[model samples]
Target chain A: MSVLEISELTKSYPVPGGGEPRRVTVVDVPRFVVSAGEQVALEGPSGSGKTTLLHLIAGIVAPTSGRIVVAGHDMTALGEAARDKVRARHIGYVFQTFNLLQGCTALENVAMGMAFGTGVEAGRARELLERVGLADRADFLPRQLSSGQQQRVAVARALANRPALVLADEPTGNLDRRRAREALALMREVCAESGAALLLVSHDHDILSQFGRVETMAAINRAFATADGNSPVETR
Target chain B: MSRVPHHPVALLVRRSLRQHALSSAVTMAAVALAVGLVMSVFSIKDQARNAFTGGTMGFDAVLGARGSPLQLVLNAVFHLETSPGNIPWSLYEEIRRDPRVALAVPFALGDNYHGFRLVGTTEKLFADFEYRKGRRFEVEPGGRMFDPTRREAVVGSYAARRTGLRVGSTFQPFHGLFFDPDTQHEEEFTVVGVLKPTNSPSDRVIWIPIEGVYRMEGHVLRGSGEVYTPSPHEEIPDEHKEVSAVMLKLRSPAAGMALNQTVNRQGTVATLAWPIAQVMADLFERIGWAHRILTLVAYLVVAVAAGTILASITNTINERRREFAILRALGARRRTVFGTIVAEAAALAGLGSLAGYVVYLAIVATAAVIVRAQTGVVLDVLAWHPVLVAAPAGMTLLGALAGVLPAFKAYATDVASNLAPAS
Candidate 1:
């Protein structure tokens, strides 16, 4: 069964009128799907609505039109509150800049991820941080940690609630090759270990190649990449 | 990505508060100062009232040769100042013998030591007087209870303390109505005893037998050549006798008001006054208006302090926008963020108000000894009712208002716009 299914998804923005009111089309997805337990990469050039698409899936931003079914819930049909509930229950998000809260320690950061849940998913977050090789850095504040360590903390925090779908936007964008590869592999591994599907957005082709499926966004619409990083070839 | 709180928000709040410790301290200090000012005033008033009421516990009313009600009180109850006019010994004898009068103590005042007044009244004056902490005129070592013909004297606690006079100390008291070193008479009297501390006007008095006062005056006015020691059989002349005022204890508390009116109608201008009523009126004038004015000033100060806090917090709201959005994205409700800001405001205000209350207590305590030593008025600092109400009310109100600005900002945060990618 598909973990994420998108059909005829459309999103647009209204440009404030100086002379004329015009709508800017941002994303148009005719069809998309990610099977449970699959690792997928979402790649696009600058201004390709990669972040917007990621935000739309994460329930942080409302899409103009779409039929999005994630983990059996119709995202397009849910209200803001319901979307929040769904996000809290089943979704994990990693930002491009590693938006770690500056005030909390790595462990506390991971722990707080459970605030929206019943309690700290005991051992789950600490286990994830340890898996990311920052277990010793658990007490270090986010600002005190290196960029790589911060990202690991974010990754640990993201998986704190053991969500079913992990959405990462440029998850390794700020790291060197080794750290980037380590972060990507960690995300893919955690997704599989936690029974969640991984969907990552990145501009790096090296990172893109790790995923079995790739989606490239354009101004007019979204297109899927062939496994070899070739042009879009439609699949039924 | 994780849960709300997720360590990030908590970390942020703690670090932010620590980083701005100076600001927090300043706010707290402002609150503390305001609270202290209000607390000191309330404490002093409480102390003053306690001393005043404590000095005259059992008396229902005081009657005198009426002039000023305040003067009557000052003479009959306080015994520290002159009465408006003298009531004849015959009249006092009549009141003392009346069936309606329980006990009448006559007060004669006309002399002083430095500025401290000397009151010569019968032994009944000390016997009838009550004081705080259940104290009375308990004579200590060397102090004498008035022996009418013995010419012995008892000095009040404060007077003895200030002058370092022991019981049996013999010296000629300054015989003038007010202190005059050069004009002190040659008549010598022995201090027989010292009374205990009584935080009242009585604390600074030198109580002599009413007869001693008259005799002392006679010796001075008639000169040594004309005055001689009286024989045990000879009667003191009537022309040399007088009393400043009389303190009347009626048959019952119920008869006090009626008896005071009857005493006032005795073809005399002497005014009768209730000590409690006079004290209430005095308090209204001294504390009521002053306290209201001070409280108004405090409210204004709190308003300004709150504005400064609001400005500081809201000024940082932009920097906190991303933080708010991130928390919201992590499942923080708009109301939650709003509530947090409000809570922060209340916390700051609460701390500041508490500090202010402490400051007030310190000031009152500092002033107590000096006020007592200088003016003989004891100011107590431990009174709690006003402190309890004012500190919390001031802080809560100021803090609530301060938080409203930041909470409103937090509530209005739009997640998508705040987290939007830079253009």
Candidate 2:
């Protein structure tokens, strides 16, 4: 079963200047799917609508026209609040900078993921911290943790509610190469363990080499396909 | 019992408070100060009203030379203001001998030892006057009231403690309402006794025989040295003698009304003030504007405190946009985000109000000491009033109201832009 399904999805923001003839389309995905528990990589250069597509899939922004089904919830059919609920119960987001709340401990950051959805369970938060191998650092704030450790906490928090999908937008973009590799391995393993599909968006070629299956934005986004006229990239 | 888990808003609020500890503390301190001032004003007002209106200091009416009835009560009963003018001793005698009069204590005030007033009256005044309900003047152990015709003085409890005058301490009278070194009388009066604590205005006075005031050398009798007797201890004649005011306790309320009608409405010589508590109440009512201004100033402080919260939080919203957006991306609703800010304001105000009682106690305790020192009125510092409940609730509500504009600003933060990658 597909944890995420997208069809004919596109997003557009108005041109900065006020005019009737305006609105620049950023995302134009023809079709996409990520099966439950699968780990997929999306590779594209910066400003190529890679982030916009991810946001569309996460329902962070409404699609100008199309359907996005996150887990079992029809993202396009829901309001902003309902979309938030979908994001809470199904999709876990990991930002590039590992945006752990500055004041909260690693365990509290994990518990906070559950706070808006199910209620906070301290024992469960501790379990996630332990699973992420930060058991001894449960009480340490994000700043206290190393870059790799902060990413690891972000991974634990993403999987905190055991969501159906984890949307990671360059989760290791701020880390060293070794830390990035380790962070990638940890996120994939954790996503696999929790049976949550992973769609990791990154522009780095070396990072794309690690995934079993990878899809380039040049292929999936018809907006990019039409604009660049580039053939689909390699996929396995 | 199991401890309930904190809600997401509470969790966020708790963590944010820790994150912004300094700004939060400053805002709360401002609120505490405002709340403290407001509570103190209200407490003092209620206590003052109680002190002034609750007991008439055991008198039913005051008869003095024609003037403001309140002035008559002030000088005669409270030993406060100067008597309007001195009524003839003949008028005092007529009131004293009336069947309607249960007891008449005539006061003659013209001197002070330090700041405490010296009131010259008969020993019968101390023996019969009730300072509170069922409470009479009590002399300290091994002491007694002054002799009726001697220059001896009975020091009040507060006077004894303040002036360090005891049963045998002697001090010359300063012959005026205020103490003046140059106007000191030649005759020295010995402290024959000391009265126990009365917690009334009387506790701040020195008592001597009326005849002593009449014979104090500078006090001219009948506009000449009309010697009733060659000896200084002899009685001064009625035509020559004068009393500042007479505090009268009536046999019945009907007698008081009858006297009020005759002396106040019909007679021309003296002013009659009846139902002494009402007279005191009227005095408070006249000065009530000052109390209102104090209360208005307190509320203004509350407004400024609320404004501080608003400005502080609104300023924070600029820095916290990302955090709120991140919360939105985490599945927290807009109202949840809005409630986080509102709840923080209310929490700050609530904490301030709790601390405000500490501030209030400090203020009231200081006022209590000063009042006890000057007027012998004991203020109950820790006494609870309705404003204690209403003030905190009102301030917190005001705090919540203050947070609304900032909460709106926070609520409008777009999740997609704010939660996007920093790179």
Candidate 3:
């Protein structure tokens, strides 16, 4: 069964000031699908609309025109609140910066991943932390952990709610070469172990070489990879 | 899905309070201080009024030489203020014989022992009069009422405690209201009894027989000198006898009113203070501005404390935008984010309000001592009052109200942008 399916998804943003009245289309994906238990690497340089595509799939930002179904829920048709619920119940995201809550323990951060979903499942959080080789470090806060360890905790959090799909955007961007390889291996191995599909985006060729299946932004999205998606969007 | 916390917002708020312990404590302490002050002002004001009026517990009216009725009540009943001079002893006999009167106790004042008043009354005051409803003047187990014919006295409980004068103690009376070494009388009076604490102005007095006051060597009546001590065979003339004030308890409320009209309007000798509670309540009404000013100041402190809550939360909100964004990314709704901010404020105020009672107790305990010293009314610091419950609850509600501004700021937080690396 497919965990993620996107068809003719496009996101366009209007220019900053209203003078010439031009709109930039950041994401124009004709079709995309990731079956359960599949791990695919998406390769893209900076400002190539890779993050925008991930945002659309995650329902963090709405698509200008198209349908996105994640774990059988229609992401495009849902309101922001409903979309948030869908994302919480179906998708887990791992940002490059290890966005763990600074004030919470590793265990607490994992629990927070399940906060909006199943209330909180402490035993499951502990089990995931133990699986990530951070059982002894569950009480430690984010600042107390090393960069590799933080990413490990983030991976644990991503799989906390038993998500159907995991979207990792440059997950190993800050790690050294060996740590990056190890982090990627652990993330992909966990996704496979948990029967969740993994779609990881990275710019490094070395990182993409490890994946059995890989595709570049130009191949998936037909839009020009020019605008770095930091501005407001307007659907035309 | 946690260790039974039930909600992450509360858990997050608890952690945030610990993280910013200093600012949290400062804001909470401000809230606690305001709650304490507001509660204390209402408590002490109410207690003082009750004690002042309650001092007239068993008496129906006060009759003194023509003077301000308030002054007469204060002077005779409370041992406060100066005596409004003296009325003839015949007037006391006339009131005592009146059919409307049930009990009449005469007091002659004008002397002191170390600033404690010396009231001259018959032994009937200790044996028959009730200082409070159904509670008579109780002397210590080994003590007795002062001997009416001898130079003996009964020390009130507070006067005994303050001056260390117990039974068998002796002291010379001063000729004036204030204790003066030069004005000390040559005559010595024995302390034969010590009355128990009545928690009224009566507790601050030294009681002697009326004969001692009238025949005290230098006491002159109608310029008669009366220099020598009266013999057992020779009695003071009825025409020369005088009394300062008479405390009356009438048979009925109507009788009190009739006597008040007759003595105050028809006759010209004495003023009658009927309905003693009203006299005290009127006094509070006259000085009501002070109570209002205190209440206003307490409310102002609460407003300032609420401002601190606003400033404190707003300051932290700016730094924690990413934190909130992270929660949004974690799938927390905007309402959850809003609830978290409000809960933090309410938690601070609620915790502070709980601690406010401690502050209130400390303040009232300190004020109670001062009040008891100034006016012998023992304030019950631990007594329950409506303000006790209202102040803290109001503070917490106000705290939640204060959080609305910052909660809105948090609710409008841009998750997509704030989630971006702030570099």
TM-score of every prediction relative to native: 0.82, 0.93, 0.93
lDDT of 3 at A74: 90
| Second chain TM-score for model 1 | 0.79
- Please write out the lDDT profile of model 3 over residues B145-176, one tens digit for every residue: 98888899999899999998889998889897
Report lDDT per candidate.
0.69, 0.84, 0.86
Descending-TM-score candidate ranking:
3, 2, 1
* Model 3 residue B167 CA deviation in Å: 1.8
Model 1 CA deviation exceeding 4 Å by range: A121-131, A219-236, B1-16, B36-57, B64-66, B74-91, B110-117, B131-135, B139-194, B197-201, B204-208, B211-239, B275-287, B363-380, B384-394, B420-423
Q: How many residue pairs clash in each candidate?
A: 23, 0, 3
lDDT per residue as tens, model 1, A1-236: 99888888867767665988886656678778888878888777655667667667767777788788889989889887778777766777787777776666787777666556435654676677788898788778788899988998888888887777888878888899999998888888878888888888788999999887886664225432222233222110
Better of 1 and 3 by TM-score: 3
Superior by DockQ: candidate 1 or candidate 3: 3
Residues B74-188, model 2: lDDT tens digits:
7877777776888788888899999999999898888888878889999778788887778888889989888886789998898899899998888988888877778888878
Highest-scoring model, lDDT: 3
DockQ for all candidate structures vs. native = 0.25, 0.42, 0.42
> Which portions of model 2 show Cα errors greater than 4 Å?
A16-20, A229-236, B1-5, B149-151, B223-230
Candidate 1 A-chain TM-score: 0.89
Q: How well does candidate 3 match the true structure in TM-score terms?
A: 0.93
